[model samples]
Target: MSVGLVIRLIVLALLVAFLVSPQTFVFVFRPLVRAGQPVIYNQGSLIDLTLNHLAIVGTAMVLATALAVGLAILVTRPFGAEFLALSRSLANIGQTFPPVAVLALAVPVLGFGTAPTLVALFLYGLLPIFENTLTGLTNLPPTVTEAARGMGMTGRQRLMRVELPLALPVILAGIRLSTVIALATATIGSTVAARTLGEVIIAGLLSRNTAFVAQGGIIVGILAVLIYDGLSAIERMLMRRTGQAGRQA
Candidate 1:
């Protein structure tokens, strides 16, 4: 079969698995509810879960980008590159720690609620965005930068005009990855008593309700797909704009 056809078949199979049984049965878990009220996964509950999740993830994205990009820029300088090894070590360590363990540890300092969740997401998101930002800037033609400076462009002007536009796609890829992962991890926040779709999954497990688990898990999957795809679309648009700008200049 053609590659596109194979992909289409795979997607169809996945859709069927999700909609039907066996997959939802969760061999490791049993059904939670029976008849009447099975922790109903309605529009309202999902909205409540999703909205709070979006807030936490969005906040993390902003914070991660700011810190990652800023630090990447700072560390790219000769003085800063001296500390690159240390910077990379710290980022690697941050990602290596288990998120639940981190959350449990942070609870004492950050207290409960969305704050801890946001902190967790922000830290988790840092490495990808930071690494990609550093990579893109470093990969830029050194001669291009020298030429811009030779043309009397200020540091700010060179960065805004040359570095940022060129580096945007790689940075966006990192951000998109961060966003989807944050969406998945945000579900764990519900376990910590944060308001999130994970509440449904947790409650289902607590009460032995498969329906609740399926509903929550399914919604989260859907949300992740939409958000990732949306970010990718934005990245494509940005890339196109970059190309057009380069052509124009």
Candidate 2:
């Protein structure tokens, strides 16, 4: 096997082993702490947090996609384009607010729970998705769009069949960006007593337990890597299919 492929396999094996281990954390499982480790807790709190991260990130992704697509479509028109600068400015503001602060403010109104966290995440996720969708749509070759219009295609038909397919890759890239940000930020949710992997880190930090923090942080890292990679694989597959179909006679 190629050296790069072999290394990749080894890393994947280690990640899967650590993920499935009873200790559920590398620090807790270590005896002397240098590659060889013993199991501690036969439970997986980190896995639970990983699951929660997925939920938060998924929710953010849905909101981001809807908002970005809406804004992209709206701004494409002459009259609506008047508000393009304003729309982008508002999106910029959403991201400018510190997510933790946003969560803190949301707590009283939404209560101290996942609802506030999701709200923060949704705002955090919006700008990238919205901007990319707009860029992708506007960058479409004029000739191709003109041909679609010449074929008696309605606006919706051109958007759904011709324009959106061309823009799909960039749209998915926005989703990938939002996913990673949400995973990392979701750790903060533990501060508000949310039932996420953040719980492990906060508990450990409060108690000065390195094992808890390391375990929680590492699991979240792995979860982000895994999800990002999984989505990338799906994106590549879809892109290949679309490209091949677009090229066929």
Question: What lDDT does each candidate get?
Answer: 0.77, 0.75
- Candidate 1: lDDT of 31? 44
Q: Tell me the TM-score of model 2.
A: 0.83
The pairs that clash in candidate 2 are 49-197
**Which candidate should be chosen as best, given TM-score against the real structure?**
2
**TM-score for all models, in order of appearance:** 0.80, 0.83
Please report the candidate that would top lDDT against the real structure.
Answer: 1
